[model samples]
Every structure is written in structure tokens, then in C-alpha cells.
Target: MPADDSPTGLSQPLYLCVADELGQLIAQGQLAAGERLPSVRELSQRRGLSPTTALAALRALEQRGWVEARPQSGYYVRPKLRRLAEPATSRPPSAARPVTVGSIAARLLAASNEPGIIGFGAAIPEADWYPVATLQRLASQAARRHRLLIGEYSPFFGLPALRHQIARRYAELGIAVDDDEVVITNGCMEAINLALRTVAAPGAVIAVESPTYYGLLQLIEAQGMQALEIPTHARDGLSVEALATALTGPQGAQIRACVVTPAFCNPIGALMPEAAREALVALCRQHRIALIEDDVYGELDFAGQRPLPARYWDRSGNVLLCGSFSKSLAPGARIGWLLAGRHRDAVRMRKFTTSAGTALVYQHALSAYLETQAYPRHLVRLRRLCATNVARYIEAIERYFPAGTRVTRPSGGFVVWVELPRGTDTLALYERALFRRINFAPGPLFSASGRYRNCLRLNAGRQWTPDVDGALQALGRLVEAG
Candidate 1:
């Protein structure tokens, strides 16, 4: 039997104590691979540690690839931890996998129903705040005229009217694109996927911002592409110097593309400065690399002037601009488009094979909605609401979280990044919060290498309801108790 010594009296921190115990259990073969471990709550209760401490321990184990977490259910030893393969030069044949919407729905629904839980987790706008009535009117009008078109297949690129609207919108951003340059996809996610597929083969090396949107990391992993994380700043987006170093250095030449979110990036709402943006475009040009710009949150900026995307500086047509109405409008609409620039024809063909085309009816509806003067007015109001809510969230976080808790002051976007005091495990906090009828996204999810264990991103888009305050207090209590 393993030593039964109490976790107390260890010279290390309490979280370390918990982690050491788990490590010992695994070493003793008492916790074998695929074996279910105690739930975060059960472990906390058994060890007399706060739930936060228990979660930190588990997250540490998770980072080491020793465990896996299933939604709703407790933690279990991973069946196998797959190591990221080294970068390769060739493409692999496509393999078909079952698309499971159920898993995604379960996670979203579970997160939605948590009592006393402030939903700072999803990137979605609050349900009541979006312009639902306007969309309804637009949809009705579109159906009145395009009833026949709804039953037919949309062109592989997209509905012509929608593409024209997209191109016109890009003109305002200083990106000179015509209707043919735009390719509609299910959402910005698919736009990005198609862009990556068009430019690079599987197992190819691609550069991505550190602490990028978790969805992007998942996409890279799914495509069997290896990502080299370029160090980025909280205030200025991706560091051009770091990127230049990566590009000119040994790893730079092999990188097929660089993916960035230039404006109001997810997790970190950094907007690249104009000079930095120029430099980035120049760097990509110098290195002959493709720059895939994810600008999903560009329209949500509430601070200074909304900076144009890096695509504006793409004189060489190396930049692919991917954007969507998912964040600005309702996510269910799933209307997203891409300006593939030089890769237009390649992307068009990929779009033909992959989902055929985005829903034509939604595209027409959104196009009509965009033509109205109300769209920009609605966006202005939405930005103000997000800014106000984010300010309140910062105040609440300051009041409740312990000293030394570092929170990001994002100029725009609905998410906030909180850096907890070192050694705090957010995943542990997540598990504990679940029991308290709260849910949050843990930090490690945003990293490709499973780093950032002490960091957590909160969705500040929702209103500061009483339940939200209570949840913040609860989270604070968990941190302090640890």
C-alpha cells in the first residue's frame, strides 16, 4: 500500500500536495490508465482541501497528459495521450470521422443551465440583446421573394447578393475585394479551415499566435497540422519580432502559413497597432508566407478607432481574411465568408467539396439586413453594452479576487482573461464551480501545449445580474480558501 500520510505537513504548497498524492497513486498503479479518479468534489472532501486546490492538482495532471475530463462526468485516466507529430512536408489522405453535434450541444446546454453561474464562458452575445426582430423582418422579406431559391442549392461560392454585400463591406475596411473574392462557409471556423486546407498540406508547419482561440488549435490538430506558437503581447496582438525571429530562424522557412486575429482577438482582446500590422504584412511578404487573418471580433471594438486588418496591407495577396457574423449577429445564423485573395479559386473548389455552400436563405436574409442602415447602428449599441458590462465585470473581479490577481483590460470584445496567482488551478475551480451550479472555461484549453494552467478566460458579455455577483463571490471564496 502507498504511504497514508496526511497531505498536510508537506513543505510544498497545498496544490502541490494534492498533485503529489495523485502522482503517487498513478505511480503505484492504483490509478491505472482509463481508471476513473475521484471527482474534484470527492477529492476535495477526502483531502480536506478547498475545491480550488483539488482542481489545480487535477489540472497539473491533465497538463502532463495523465488524465482526461468528460463533460458532466468526473475525471478519468486518459486511454492514451497522443503526442503532436513533428512537422512534415507531405499531405495525408483524408479520413472520414463521425461528426458528433451531440457532444457540442451537451457542453453548451450544461454551461447554459448552471444556476448562480455567470456565463462568461461562451463568445455568444446575450439572447435578449441581439436584433432578433430585425432579422425576423429580413427573413420574412427574403422568403417572400427568394422562396424558390431556398429550395435550390446555393452557388459553391455563395449567394451572389451576399458576396456583393461582403465585398462592399470589405471596401470600407480598405480591403479591395470583388464579389468573386468572397467564399461563404458555415461560419468563420469553416472559412479558416478552408483557407488552411487551400494553402498547406496535412502535417505542415504553421505559425499561430500564442494563447490563440482554442477552436483554432482544435482545427490545426484535426487537420494534422503542427502549430508553432508565435509569442504575442496582450496589448499589441502577435509580436512581429518574435514572428520575424521564427521566420528567419531555423523553423521559419518551413512554416507554410501564419494565422492571426489582428483585431479584438479571442481570449486576449489585443488589437495590433497600425505599424505592427504593416510590419506583419511585410514580414509575411519577405518570408513568402501566407497570413490567415481571423477578424471575427473586429466589429466589436469599443475603444479607439477600429483598426483595419492586416489584410489591408497585403499587396502580394498573401493574406486571407476570414470573418463571420457569428459574434456580431446570432451564432445560429452561421453566416460567414472569406476573402481568399490569391487562393480564391483553390478555396472555392474546397468549399464545393466540403459543405457545398452556406445556407442560401440565411445569406440572403443577412444580406438584406446589411443593406439597411440599422446594421451599423445596432453594432454601435451592442459595442457600448459590451463595454459597459466588461467594466462592471472588472470592478467585480477587483472586489472579489485576491490581491495579485491580474485581469486584462481589453478595449473591446466580450471575453476577459484573468491571470490568477501562481499555482492556482482554474480547471479545479471549474469542477468545483460545476457543483455550485457555475461553469467557466479553464485556461489550458486555449493553449496548444496545454500551458497556462493558472489562467482563466471569462465571458463578460452577459449582464451583471445578481446571480453573476454571487458566482464571482463564490469563485473568490474558492480562491481565498485555497
Candidate 2:
């Protein structure tokens, strides 16, 4: 295969041109596993090609499993590859719930069907823009090793090497955890669920942000627990003062656990300061509350440094730290892990009973890939690309949205929260955008209390282009119409 620098003067197809450029980078070890490639526009600008040509190159790479696409976030390098293998058991089918058309979820799902709709609703990363060739090499090596460990199930916790990697990774953030403390799971959602199950019983009261991650609310509701809403701020997240007061006040007495996204929280993209994190940990310690810290977005920082989870302040083993590769790596891999301080035994028992364990092949592959140091190297590049994309999205929002529209500037993470004018219902705007084939997450889905009716969360992980800009403009029109 001739590189783009060939002097033969034979013109390569545009897609081939883009792919050759990527291939050279991978061959030179510049694009490592888990790294994101330049956005389509960025690549197009560099290669002197159009956006469609660049996308075609990326899509071709995607088909080969060289990269994986996150829902709203841009593409990311796949961790490692295993042969096409079916899950031992299909995901237990969710029973059909009565479909209520006008309900918030139904409306949101309905809006998803419209073409050319800008999605500000879902909190997924763009998956199409990742570097795939690097992942292919990682996967090839992993698959080759999988044959040797075909019958082995990782130790009840997880692969020791991966555990050690997790510990070392956390240590860089000022969290000191031993390898034995971590238990791998399917995703942060599972990690959080297992932690909650370990500490709180059905009907227990779990305090959560008033406008918390809707998934957590569902989990609480699923466990037959009541979520006590504590007021949270868009800038600080999960107010420590409010939480301290809530605990000592009447509501605190009944709370069994407190689940929070302390760093780069979802929906609002707020990063709790170190002092507040310490204070919250102290309060949880005093109140004897099991603090489940969701730090899925912690690794995607755009600011000075990544923030440590509240777990860093815990000396009493009260904090259960949940993290996942789904956000930072490949989401479809369904891999996540938790460091359940004092609650390790309960989490382990739940893991064994819930699904036995995560896919053995994937665990082995991911472990092998991590050993290559590809993940961290990939992350540095990915973060830089994400930061650039975020700035681009911010510029678009400023240009298109109404003058008084307030937007949250996230230090890291793929979500950007836009607070629209009061009384301008996002649900109504969602309907209007849907008619125009635009999809966005309405703000109400993030709230347990049905607040933030005028807010919307935009995915800033994709390559910003003329079409993306146009989509934002269309959304602005809908917002103004409302």
C-alpha cells in the first residue's frame, strides 16, 4: 500500500486518501488504541477534500471494527477486538410497558425519528470519528490471546492487571486504592446499581440531586426506593450545605444512601470543587450514609486538571466509586467497574447473582489492550479533540441561540446544558423540532422533579460542520417560536 506521500503521482480515491493518512499515523504509532481521530471537517481541511469524502473514509473504517461510534459523542478507537461472538444469553427482553404517546419519553423517542434534527437531548458521544486502525491491531493481538484463556473466567473481581491499571489511573487523581478493591461491571449504571443494592434495601430513601440523571431515578424506582431530591446548582453540583442540612434536618434521618455525580455531573455538567467534595464526604461519613460517587465523565476533562471523586476524601470506606469505559472508550463493550470500599462483599455477591460476570472474552481483550499502554495515550489525543469540538459547539450556540439564553461551560464531558428563557417549554420546542426532523433531549428528562422544562442538553462531541451549524440554527428557530 503506497502512502499519501508517494511520488508516483497516481491520484488515490478520496476515501483511500483519508484512510492512507490514518494508516500512516497508525503504522507510525502516533494514533494509539482508544484515541479519537480528527473530526471529518478537520481531516477534510487537512486533506483538501469535502466532508462527505472524509465521512466515507471513517464509515469504511467503522465497518471493519477499527473504531466504535458513541451515540452522541464522536467516534473513539475500539479497545480491542474479539471474533464475532454472540452473547451466551441474549439480554433478557424488557417486557413491553404500555406506550403512552404524549409522555415525555414517548415524545423524546418520537422526535428521534425526524431527519436532520439536531440532538441536544441524549448524553452520548459521537462514535463515527474515532481512529480504528490502532484498535484493529490491539484487537488482533487480544483475539490471538483469547484462545489461550478460552475457558477461564476472570477472578470474581476482575483481571488483576486491569485492576492494577485502574488503581494506578485513580492514584494520578489523588485517589489511593489497591487493586483488590475494584470489581468490574457492565457499565457505571450497573456499578451504581450494585452499590445501591449493597447499601440500601427496597423502600429505602436515597437522596439524589433534584434534577438528577434520569437513569438513576429509574434505578431508584426499580429498586422500590424513594429518591429524596436535594437541591443542586448548575455551577457547583450537589450542594454540600444543602446536603448537610438535609441530613441533620428531618429528611436526613431516613436516608440510607446518597448517589451523586461529583465530577462533571450529567445534565448540568457541573464539577464539584475539591472543598465541596471533602465536605460532602465528611457529611456522609457523619450521617453514616453510603456515598455512591459516579465519575464516568471524570477522564474527559478539558480544564486544567481532572477532578477527583468524593471517594478521595473518604477514609472510613463510605464512598463507593463507579466508573466505566462506555463513556471514555467503547460503549457497546458494556464494561464498567467499581471500587466498593467497605461494601465490597455485597457488591461481589450481587455481581455473581446478577449476570455471573461480564463477558469473559471482552474482559480478557480489554485487559490485554490496557497492558499495551494504548488507552492512556489514546485518551490524551481524544481529550484534545474533544476540547476543540466543545469550543466549536460553544461558538455555534452563542451565534444561534437567543441573546439571553444561558449555557453551562463544562470543564470536561460531551454535554453542554442550555437554559432557555423561562416559560419556553423545551417539550414544546422538541415537538416543533421533530416536525422539522430534528431530535434533542428535552430538559425534563434529566429531572426527577420535572423541573428544567426550558433546558436542553447538547452533545458537543461530534465534528461540528455546516450541517451541524444549520441544525443548531434550526433549533434556535424552534426555541424562538416557543
Candidate 3:
């Protein structure tokens, strides 16, 4: 073991810092596979840490799949997971088209909850993955603390404390924001909706990443707006050059807004690079287009650092930054927020008319949770679990799926986009898989043009289990039979 440094002035927990350092060593091949790790006692003595902290670091490593423990033996470096080639960049039609995603999304959601079904459909985190007990306790405490206000409607934007916490997080990203500028929403769904309503008029064209989140498509469809699907990379995220072409061409005049998930986009899990993000912000600003950023998955980066959102470069106030705690915390809490730069008032109006305000209890509870260091600690564990589970899913797909199956190597988030061989209709595959009590997101739901017929999005949020493995094998067999 190398000499450890003092943990003063660290950004995250001391144990997390130690674990990250050790994990990097393992990643860099300094700690070969199957090599025994230093015992907790020795590690503590050498690093001048307490036994509890040293053991916690090792346990964190175990959770993140950096090392494993054996009976009467200390932790040992685990073998690296196999990586598959990522899917190619998407090529949806350049022209803006009306979104018409039907009831498939709802059907998938319903099927995902059915008994006997192995759900790999919805992007929701597994229930057990959350700090349910802690959240519940906080909720109870909030109820007692704000009992008089529980029956009354919350403030138009939200509780001040929660908004301040949200603002504090953005400040960490180097974005200056006032707590009063934040508006609470039902979830990222409503935040996007509010942003859309505030920025674009009905029947206007909204640009989006090809094979984008179906929820965004549905929102566009519901608002009677047209979506111009831009070509998107499976790894590098929204192609700024492709978008630039669209914005400068004949249809450029028609574009009113661009909705993007820059970090760990759903379905595809693409992390737009910092350069791309800056260019995107500049492009949107140049074209006078509203850039609505859905940053719900921003905190789930596997690399332990949150990528700066496209909003980070917006000086003209054209960027509407949206985020939610659903992915990193409790989804049922339904707590989401928006930092609508120039359209703050408009968004507030939209939010007031649409949902009045978010539930006060959740806002209070989440605020209380944020006041403690528990949220950061919980996020550390959540990110590790998500990284491990995503790797497991990719490995299983490589081992079980048909040949020519390509999966995204997401650096963050809990979903992977899988592209099977051409002529493989995943909708058809999904029908059969459901018949066998298996559920996964069919790719057609991801596009306004109903593209990606051979592709599908797998939820890698669940822990590895025999049932999940068996389901994957069965799904592979079904694909083969076709």
C-alpha cells in the first residue's frame, strides 16, 4: 500500500476519498486481479485511519466491484469486466416531425410492475437501492416540524430551504444562482414541460437528440409541438455539428427550442463532453434557440464527478436547467427543480397554472435530508451500485445476446442502449418477452419517428440475481429463435 495523505479539505467523505484512490490504483493495473489487499488493521495503521473507516473503505470498494472479500481473507482485486463496442451514432431524419408515441410507454410501465415479470423496462431505480428508511424518517420529522403548514398549499415556487439546497448544488458546479430563482416541479417531467411551455409555442419545432428519452417525446407530442430529431452519438451525446447544420439550414428558422440530456442521457447513457456542451450552448445562443437541459441523471456519473451541464456556459440566459432527485434518491418523492434563466417568470406562471406547486411535505423532507451530510453519502453508494449493475448488465448482454449485438459503455447512469442485428424488431421481441414474463424498453418508444426498431434500452439499475440472469438468457434464446 502507498502512503496515504491527510483527508483535510476533501470534497467528499474521507472513506470515499480513500476508496477512490485505491479504486484508481486497481483501475491503473497497479493492483492485479486476485492480488490480496492490505488488511483493514494494517491499512488503518499505515494510513492513520481508524479501523471502522478503513473497513468502510474496503466495503465501499467491494460494493463498487473493485475488490471482493473471502472467508477469513481480506479483500482482493476483482477481474475487470469485459467491454463491448458501443452502438453507432443515430441518424434520424433531419426534418422536424410531429411526435406520435402511442400507449407503448404506459404499457411498458404497467408491465414492469406486474408479478413474475423481470422488469428491464422503466429507468426507475430499484426500491431497495434508495435510503427509504432515512427518507421516511425525515418525512415524519418534517410533518411534525411543519404540521401547521401541511394542509396549506406550498409557496408558488417551493419551500425556500429546499430551493437554497438546490442552489447550493449548482453553485458547486460553478454556476451562480439565487435560491429565489428556483421553481419546484412535480419531477423532471414537469420541469421539462414547464420549460417547454415557457419557451416554445404550440406547433413550433423543438430540436432533440435522436433516440431521445420517450418522456421528452411524449411531452412534445402532448404540447402539440413538432420535434426535429438530430443525429446523436451513443457515447459522446448530442452531435453539436449535426445540430449546427440543422440550425443553419432551411428549417433553422422554424426551430424554437432544443431539449437535451447532456450527462448520462436516458436510454442511451451518453455523456456529452465539456467541449461539446460549451459548443452546444454557444450554438443555441447563436441561433436564438431555447436550450432546455434535463439534468436528472447528472449526479449518477460513475466517475465520481458530475459533468458540467450545457447550462454552465449560458451567459445570455437562454438555458433552462432542469434537475430532479428521483434518479439519485426516491422517485416517489417527485421532487424536481428548474433554473429557467430568462424565462423564470414564465415558468413560474406555467408551474402555477399546471400543478400549483409541488407537494410541500416532500420539499420539506428533502430539504431536511440535504441539510445533513447524508445525501452526499447516499449518492456515493448509489453511484457505485449503478456503475456495478450497469457493468454486470453489459457483461451479461455480451455473454447471452446474439452476435453483432452492440451495447453502450456508459460512464455514468443506470441504463444501456443495446443495438441488436438489423431486421430484429425489438417491438416484436418485446411482445414475446412480455409473454415470457420479461420486460424491457423497446427502442421505438425513444424516437419521434419510430426509429431504432432493432435497438432496445435495458434497465441496469437492479442488483444481479439468478432471476435476472435467467431472464437475460431466456431473452437471448427468444432473439435466437426469431
- Arrange candidates, best TM-score first: 3, 1, 2
Best candidate, TM-score? 3
TM per candidate:
0.76, 0.76, 0.86
**Which one wins by lDDT: 1 or 2?**
1
Candidate 3: tens digits of C-alpha lDDT, residues 261-309: 9999988999999999999999999989999999999999987998988
Which 10-residue window in model 2 sums to the lowest lDDT?
85-94
Q: How many steric overlaps are in each model, in order?
A: 2, 20, 0
lDDT of all predictions = 0.75, 0.71, 0.86
Model 1, poorest ten-residue lDDT window?
A: 84-93
Query: Across residues 13-67, which tens digit of lDDT does each residue of candidate 2 receive?
Result: 5585455446434433467778998788887898788999988887756754556
